[model samples]
Target: MNWQELGKQVADYAPLLGGVLGGPSGAAFGTILASKFGTKETPNDIAAAIQADPNAALKLKEVESNNETKLQELYLKDKQNARLSHKDSRMPAALSIALTLFVVLVVYLLFFAPVPDASKDVLFMLLGVVVKEWSNAMQYWYGTTRSSSDKTKLIAARN
Candidate 1:
């Protein structure tokens, strides 16, 4: 099974770790889960272990709590790297502009252009792609809800 599927199964027990398992760094987090559970380094095995053990959820929570600091560090480092890359290259900016233009074009086509019934489906599919890409670009440029939530948590902890 995929990491996402495994993540769903694990979510009931450890929401934070399940989210990590479902993200871009799922494999890395999966390895951590495997090691913690004494299972093989695979989503399937880890999921099975989680199912077999009655205390899996509690153990997973402990693992998540123990690794929380590392997770935060990883998130900070990733954001730092993105910022550094943006400073060194114009590709991200260029791509963001291109994506924005494409989205605008798609919106115009959907609303104003005479789209054929047959072509409408294709256009809609392209629109979905554009929307997902636009969201990624927005996240890269403005940060995501996760970052905002993290910031809030940090502020709360400081108080």
Candidate 2:
């Protein structure tokens, strides 16, 4: 019934909950909230851990409901905050010009990279592929760390 045990329980059920929610967000939020605010034990486990008082049960239910509401609110707030803070092209015209120039430069490089060779195009394409793969790997790493850290913090909070 301690936070550590409760956290393990949450982690155990997270995959199932993630499937139900169709995303990792739901499972991560549920696990964190349950561990942070809800009783140390799951709803079913609560009754036996503490005295089965009607008032306590009612309070527990209230807390669970509020936790869910708060979780949704937090999620929405975070989304809104991210949307608001996300890059709003300060100079769209300039950005477009820069992008066009970059594309032209790439084309120029592919056609003529100091050395007249078909391998230039192949090397450019390989470089682009490598950059794309690296970007994807970084994004995946960030998302995973964020979710894992969130769960870790909630678990640590219990101790």
Candidate 3:
């Protein structure tokens, strides 16, 4: 079965694992699922197990909850790696700045400019995408509350 199909099925039970299954690291996450579920390391096997067992969803949730700490560590590590990799590169910051400027321009145009009826729909769609991406860019640059909390926990533990 395709990753998307498996992800959809698993998402109903384990949202986090489902997301991982649907992402770029689906195969790796599938291996984890397989080990936990005692299935073959394949989406098809995992999907079948989830479908066959009535308690599979509960089990999946339990598994995710139990491994939440490890998952958070992995997530934080990935973000740290990304930040380190981009430390010397200006592209990420430049992109964020550009996106900020574009969002401002789009909002200004929408509020003040006389947009043509035919182009308004396209512009609105573009605006939606740009705004969403701008939020993501800001989050990447500033870090999210979850990340901040994790940092606090780390510091507390270190002390």
Candidate 4:
């Protein structure tokens, strides 16, 4: 049997394993299960065993419960860390102050300042661009960016 073929089988099973577990991290369940239970057998052997054992799915589902609990715990810990870090950082406070000042300036320019209509229009357009750019930057930083290594793995798996 081809080594890669066996790997492909496991890869194919990963999503199913994930589905049984039911979570964002379910895709990782296959790797964890393989590590825990896979010893000498190839993926084919494991599949055959699972087919033969009537209680295999049940057992795997039981493991999924444990995995889901651990995943949830990790998520909570990460969220708590994020909150604490946000509180400790000065950037958020600085940004808030700067945005408040900008709002005040915009209100003044629009309502109280004897600015020309043309200048006000220009300022509004410029502010719109700035806001869009800032939103894009924030999304880029906070979004889930796929790394080159992940792409490489995907391409290699395909082959």
The top-ranked prediction according to TM-score is 3
Model 4, range 1-159, lDDT digits (tens) per residue? 433443344334443343333433433544555555553344455555555666666656565556666755644665556655664466754664565567567767778879887798888886776566555444433544324435655998999
Minimal lDDT window, size 10, model 1: 79-88
Descending-TM-score candidate ranking? 3, 1, 4, 2
After superposing candidate 1, which stretches have Cα over 4 Å from the reference?
A: 73-159
| Candidate 3: tens digits of C-alpha lDDT, residues 55-149 | 89888888778777765555466566666666568787899999999999999999999998998999999999999999887886677844875
Model 4 lowest lDDT segment of ten: 15-24
Residue pairs of candidate 1 with colliding backbone atoms: none
- CA RMSD of each candidate after superposition: 8.1, 15.2, 6.3, 15.5
Ranking by lDDT: 1, 3, 4, 2
lDDT of 2 by residue, 34-136 (tens): 4544454343354243344435444444544556665455556656565446335455445445555555666676666674576776767865865565555
Whole-model lDDT, model 4: 0.54
- Which candidate, 1 or 3, would have the higher TM-score against the true structure? 3
Reference-based lDDT, residue 156, model 2? 84
Q: Choose 1 or 2, whichever is better by lDDT.
A: 1
Evaluate model 3: give its lDDT.
0.79
Q: Tell me how far candidate 4 lies from the true structure as C-alpha RMSD in angstroms.
A: 15.5
**How close to the true structure is residue 13 of candidate 1, measured as C-alpha lDDT?**
76
TM-score of each: 0.47, 0.30, 0.51, 0.34
lDDT of 2 at 13: 33
